[model samples]
Target: MALLLTANVAGRTNGRNVARLLQNQFPAGPRAFRVPGVDSLNHARGQPVSWLVTRTASISGQELFNNYGLKPNSELILGYGFSLPHNPDDTIVLKVGGIEGRWEIGRDAQGADGLWKVILSKFVEASDATYEDILDASGMLQEMLESLIEKLPEEDIAGNIEVRADVVEMFHHYLEGMSNLVAEKPPEARSQVKMPFFALW
Candidate 1:
């Protein structure tokens, strides 16, 4: 199954600036490339950025900005298209800023399009610590697991009472561990907490 991951980043950067940043930061490969900057990359690397973009020569950076209402210091939506094996156990990991999260690859509620979509939100940057520290924090991990279980269908919960209870207990321990870790950190080294949204289509 092919998945289209879209990350909408909004800060003090414009679309063109963001496009340039992606062109440099992202790997030089077939599956990843910037929009307007893609033209040059395709010319130099002999790789096609997108079929639609190739077919339509009129598509340009300015056109994308105008179409999406992207302006100076506005939110820029970047997309990455990739393929994955069609399996229920498969999961997709999303990393933004300094935060990372994951979601199982599955069909949506309607399931009409026959495509798998996994959406992960609440991504934020960590200043004083690594992404693993924030993502693996006891409270954060518990919240992530609870959110995943809550999304499960009620019919799927019939035989998982014990397993769910176990997870709850694990969450409690994680919270305790995280609290200790935080207490050990100096007050000046602590970072403010902020959550950003990330979505996949």
Candidate 2:
């Protein structure tokens, strides 16, 4: 909050003793928090902190000012500790040959769901490998996704649930994306990418 209000209090001194007034309002704390200045880490929560906050309150939490409004469910849950039941910013990324292709799955904005034949054509166009090779590697990937999904139970497997249900939902979305990729991509040379995150085979 203080971070957002600093600019409002900067030049709008209004002829009053703004510095002293702000100091009285906020005094000091454990110096646990930081306020950005010309230098990133030079300022602390001492003077004008609450003044900054109060001034920005009028604009704070307003959608126009919150850049996080478009973040996907996965990022919000893991980074910000919050998520909507249905976020339209969600995406599924397909990492192939060290290249990543993001497949949007948002309600208002997603891909046209590529045709299997078109996808396979693209694969053939991009690489020199045979159709059989692509299928074998893709089969490996699909099985990997299926196995991970299967390992996670609908209900908690034991007294302790290690993964959140929402996280599982994101994975399901990823699996859906993979299913699309596998369905369309043509056979190719053996994949050189290691499967640590996606496999042991």
Candidate 3:
């Protein structure tokens, strides 16, 4: 498995400063490299520090615990990698991922003031087309919900309930559409087997 470690230091910081900070904070293991940031590759250019931990290390289960002091079967890696600086204006993001799992450290945009965020994400491959489609649909649904919520009056309880009902109705419609598709095709010709409605929920 190929493991990648990346660190992005934003606001009044440079790639050199980030590289030095990581080196001082996590003195162990191979050194990290300073590379140009690819977040805005087409329009704006940026320089971000990053590290390729290893290409062959096992990142699954007990291997992570034995190698990086991480909890077994969990992708979270805290108190082991580089430490975050104590500057409020500066934001530092750390990401580690491989074929087995992925993890990230940053700030929570939706949380309370000064709240830190640590995320353990599941690795999804590009070849998993169905999973990718589901993720895309989920993102679209989230955007629709956010737009609807923003237009709703905060003091209106009935409006809130209406929004909830709308979402539920949309879910029911989706299930009904799926059921129609299944009914239109023979069992052997169906792309996917029909799952129980409760299981889908």
Candidate 4:
């Protein structure tokens, strides 16, 4: 099992705190590094079951939990080693509570997955891919707003339309903010990596 908490955030002290919260029990062992462009990371690839703990800012965090079908508030966990490349645009898959879902976390123009899986995973628990088969998180978010407007009662319809327009404007602002976060590099801070949980399967 592994935790992809966020991008550009690995082996932080907070990560250690979060790891302790995992529900699955595993043996204590020395922690190791498996970051991209590192030897440990390469060796772990395709090896039977290793754990990864990642931390991203809010946007990235939402994407991981939502897409994987994990509870929005539940700690994020996924099986280690992937059949698909870990590119920004690739659809990462997960099975949560025995239901499978896909999550894409970057912008459409930026060619990354959206974070709708966060809401979808929570709103629809007995999951089906059809819930997320189309519309990545970004698109789904927009559609959700439109759907909300459509469902408004006749008396409230006019006010809802005005609010929806504001939502669209605000969404663009959030997108811009996320773009900046993705582009910036981490500060020169010393972050520690903790031991990863091991599984034989």
Candidate 5:
């Protein structure tokens, strides 16, 4: 009984110490990496897992971007085979006129998750296509987006769609956002949409 009580007390003490260490070492706001301490006491394991927890000078994403030349989510995914789901420095590219040119979607223009509406509005304003073409393309684009959304299930399941839950959820979010934008605008405004990624070609 005495030994059990002693063991229980030691466990509680160890738990408190771990909690304190975590709290002090990882508060929040952009913890990039950690440096481990010397493993001299035991090649097995012990306390003092790591040493210094360094923080960047400024938390400004743009500042860090300028200093580090950070790449956007799209670029990172294509180049590095990984993606930041909530990447603040993300951008999208939309091709125009089949092969004439492309528009690089930036934060200032679309501000993340504004993919569908922004593309339509910008295309209408710039393209030299006729009103009928614009309308047809826009409608077609909406249908395509809706089709993709339908294919992408809301939640992940066992062999349900073969897509990650988070990926499914992310597309569902943006696609729903686009649908809401379509519903929000009037027929005349929607008719003015010009480019629908594939419809133009």
Candidate 6:
């Protein structure tokens, strides 16, 4: 008989780290937690990926935003705009197709019976000034998340059990690498970028 040993490693905890960075920027509220495996990390090179989240209030809960408007089957469409690189010598205007996202309410938003929805846009910038482009991405992402948080009440997620451990573990596996974070091209590559935060409002 032959015996085989296998190793199973868990995700890392950078949730606390990134959450601290977010907290430093805003006033106190529900803590920020990050998780990886929620979305696929190995995406096609050069393509941007958007992670759909129904409710920051409840991960397992339905979406809170969806309940206000639209029926259970209704849909919300969010726009995502991106700017790609073009030479100064070129006279033609540049416009890339935006990525569309949807938001829906489920058991997590309210209760099993209640429903909610979210509609958000995702954008990307691929100009010669890539660093600035990422900053723009961060700003856009932060703006959207902040707006969503403000639309909801703190009570929705207040004191609810936080998925801090899940966040920390996921961050370690997916978001903690320089190679993964930045564009490789020079001039645009030197700039620093930050991940957007979703805090309790």
Best by TM-score: 2
Q: Report the candidate with higher lDDT, 5 versus 6.
A: 5
Stretches of candidate 2 above 4 Å error? 1-67, 96-109, 112-118, 122-157, 160-201
Q: Write the per-residue lDDT of candidate 2 for residues 1-201, one digit (tens) a residue.
A: 233223335656332354444556667821112234422322221223242333333343442122344665557657655554444455544433443464443432244233222344445643564655456545555564466456443432356558777666655654443333333321222233334432432
Q: Which ranges of candidate 5 are over 4 A from the true structure?
A: 1-68, 77-85, 94-103, 106-134, 147-201
Alpha-carbon RMSD to native, per candidate: 20.5, 13.4, 21.1, 21.8, 15.6, 24.3
**What is candidate 5's TM-score against the reference?**
0.29
Preferred candidate (lDDT higher): 3 or 5: 5
Per-model CA lDDT versus the true structure = 0.30, 0.41, 0.31, 0.32, 0.41, 0.28
lDDT of 5 by residue, 1-201 (tens): 000001125445344454455566656633233212222222111222222222324343422111123556445445543444444455445443433445444443343233434445555543465666556546655564455446543433446458766555555444443333323322333445534543432
Q: Across residues 1-201, which tens digit of lDDT does each residue of candidate 1 receive? A: 111122345753244554454456544732323244422221111222332223223323523211222111101111211111221122222232344443212222122111111111233333344545543442443454345445433323355356555444434433333232222221211232234411100
TM-scores for every candidate against the unseen true structure: 0.17, 0.33, 0.18, 0.15, 0.29, 0.21
In model 1, state the lDDT of residue 144: 46
| Candidate 6 wrongly placed segments (more than 4 Å) | 1-99, 103-129, 156-201
Which TM-score value belongs to model 1?
0.17
Ten residues in sequence with the least summed lDDT for candidate 4? 185-194
Which pairs clash in the backbone of model 5? Answer: none
Q: How many backbone clashes does candidate 1 have?
A: 0
Model 4, 43-108: lDDT tens digits are: 222223223443322332332222332211111112422222222232212222333554323322
lDDT of 2 at 182: 35
Question: Top model by lDDT, which number?
Answer: 2
Looking at candidate 1, the ten consecutive residues that score lowest on lDDT are 69-78
Model 4's C-alpha root-mean-square deviation from the true structure amounts to 21.8
